[model samples]
Target: MTFEYAPAPESARVDIAPSYGLFIDGEFREASDGTAFPTVSPASEEVLADVARAGAEDVDAAVRAARAAFGPWSALPGTERAKYLFRIARLVQERSRELAVLETMDNGKPIRESRDTDLPQVAAHFFYYAGWADKLRHAGFGPDPRPVGVAGQVIPWNFPLLMLAWKVAPALAAGNTVVLKPAETTPLSALFFADICRQAQLPPGVVNIVTGDGRTGAELVAHPGIDKVAFTGSTEVGREIARTVAGTGKRLTLELGGKAANIVFDDAPLDQAVEGIVNGIFFNQGHVCCAGSRLLVQESVQEELLDALKRRMSTLRVGDPLDKNTDVGAINSAEQLARIRALAEAGEAEGAERWAPECELPSSGYWFAPTLFTGVTQAHRIAREEIFGPVLSVLTFRTPEEAVAKANNSPYGLSAGIWTEKGSRILWAASRLRAGVVWANTFNRFDPASPFGGYKESGYGREGGRHGLEAYLAGPDDRPGERHGEEEDGRAS
Candidate 1:
């Protein structure tokens, strides 16, 4: 059977180029090594654009640009710099539809998520940090806080624009200049973000976007000029980055992998719990670092919750990413699909019973049926590793303590969800859970006012709120009287 996709709002609305190059020093330039890579649409496996493959030399140029802009950009009164961030945020809003469409086309996420969740959050992140400019002096690092000289940031492909905003906004807000590398699989959104910076007329070197694969990211991270490196990706890569930068005096923060446990008690609200579980593990086809892939149900309610979960999973719509009605979309790339498949296979081999929602996945694009594995013991591979797909592993716990024990068993402490009617149980589980972000009676929720990060292998440092600004900060000498962990509360923007 052949299926046709409706045109994306911006796919037909904008003028897209045949090729995109690295954005450095306020211009588009080819990779220094003259290498190029093809970016394909995960929704259809069609070649979308040829992006420059940056090498070490290109990384140098981008870092140099960022370092050059640091003085003037850092010297600018915080309010003025804030204005540029605001301008970029406004541009993002103005072109939200185009950005959203292009995002879905290349990134393989639902258009609705690209439109509502990713795009809005991207804009809001900038806007949130925009207000933080100039306010940092009043921010609790003391009377004054100095900007870190140059930041090197590498973001994942899962949530392209949002991750860009996560890197850019906080860096700009805290007064640091940045050289950022977007994931090779989804470089289009970063190029568009660079265009918005150009439109905002932000200073020539304040932000530079270099496009490439792992090698490029490694170059950006290990560059001597970068005073700090902030990264969002897999735990393995994050560890390698940490090792490379060890003892270099370069500050670092990593938001890495996760195998979060979403626990539901017997007395919890079933309907809301079901929705949270669906959004937790299935949203974005469960590609999120903080995704809740492990489900821990109180033993008494195991059968009831499993029934509702399967029933709800069956209703999910998986197909073209451009469709506004899509509930689950294409897997990000072929390699990722293979990894998810391997993990799913491991689950079966480990004696877990796996089931998929009855839906037809696309033939051309990378696809995985929304999957769930029941009868999953703690020892099962599905419950232990990060599958990073719309696959969940269900386990049962005899008590709240057992739930907390099981939840904290994983080395990755990114995030977790708790569904319980008992206030004491909610507080207990939240406090005991090793994850950084605890969703009490909720799941997969993000806000500019909240802090998001992980505890152990999931990585460190918080993004969002005042804590998020710390990544861009330098020594205490910049602020003569600042104390660590003391927030400058009650100050207006």
Candidate 2:
């Protein structure tokens, strides 16, 4: 017997302006050319706001503003900076409900995830970095590290605010100023964050946000004044950014695409592994960069596991983003929806059997049902490429050696998961996996103190914990008066 769930929609009336301007130097202003684009809700295709489309000149202006503020911001005592960060963290918690509602509307994620997962993490990142602001000497880089000057950050639409916090918090804590670009499709949260900066009394130009598409991001990265670059997006775009910044003396960090594998061994807890598989690929409608889209199961228990997995997925509710009961929401955009459709078609064309539970979809929104592809081989396009949707490709492996080999066979290696009852087996598989982040039995778990990133084509460098601070910091030698070349008396030069 099944029971129906009552619709519990959160109030959609958040205070969003009908129009938004570029946030530069702690003030909102129109783009230099006054060009603007409308950002629509992916769920209803309704134009939420006409956001300014920042041009090259706007990007230049933002960089100049960041450059201007860098000296003052970087000169502030770490303790002072910590106070500002702490204020921002408190403000974020205070406004989390509004921000979460705004995020769900703008980015097409379920309200629960935006409220429970993303919002908490966003605040935690700020609080975590705040604790380290005055304690950098203990972080082991050096006794007195210096800021890296202006940072040019470009974050993708998925996890918009969380990504912003990831890039911005550490940069500020390390005494660096930043000019950030949020993805075109979801720029409201960042703009709202600009208000947060204002509310926290963060000094002008300390954190600047320019919202636009790829062209604007390119300009920010290639700007002559930028001292560091941080981007989280597709691998293709990452490579292009790498080429743009090469030989330019800019420190670059990228957290790009992934096709992570979730391996379930025969000895694994079947029920727990099934839940992990669901959350691994279905969370955020599988828009996550480190999502485990490929399921590598032991051949011995493949049928039983598949049955359990299908039964679990059948219960997932896919509907309105504002609904508290919705398990999956709309796709981020029509373009992303089309791409997911094309890839699913390709999977079928390549002879993989596809299955999706019977669920009615809303007629107005951009949506795709949670789907699974079985009888998938390693050579299939579904298994090789990053689908970036709520689509799972299942493949069976006969042995642990084969599972490890198959898991590492991708061009991407951001994260991987191993579900086994034996601790030795978990360690053995984790040691062999090429992923940057590995989970023994759980998936999609994150902490501000744990460094998260990937290897290979998945991109380089880490983005959390004490290690993340190094990206925006200069070593002792890089700081002239603090600790440079040794003096004859064996003191700081």
Compared with the true structure, what per-residue lDDT tens digits does model 1 show for residues 145-182? 78877889999999988999988998998778889999
Q: Which regions of candidate 1 deviate over 4 angstroms? A: 1-12, 476-493
Error of 2 at 421 (Å): 0.6
What would the per-residue lDDT of candidate 2 be over residues 223-327, giving only the tens digit for each residue? 877889999999999999999999987899999999999999999999999999999999999999999899999999999999999999899999999999999
Q: Which residue pairs in candidate 1 collide?
A: 141-482, 142-482
| Deviation from native of the Cα of residue 413 in model 2, angstroms | 0.6
CA deviation > 4 Å runs, candidate 2 = 479-493
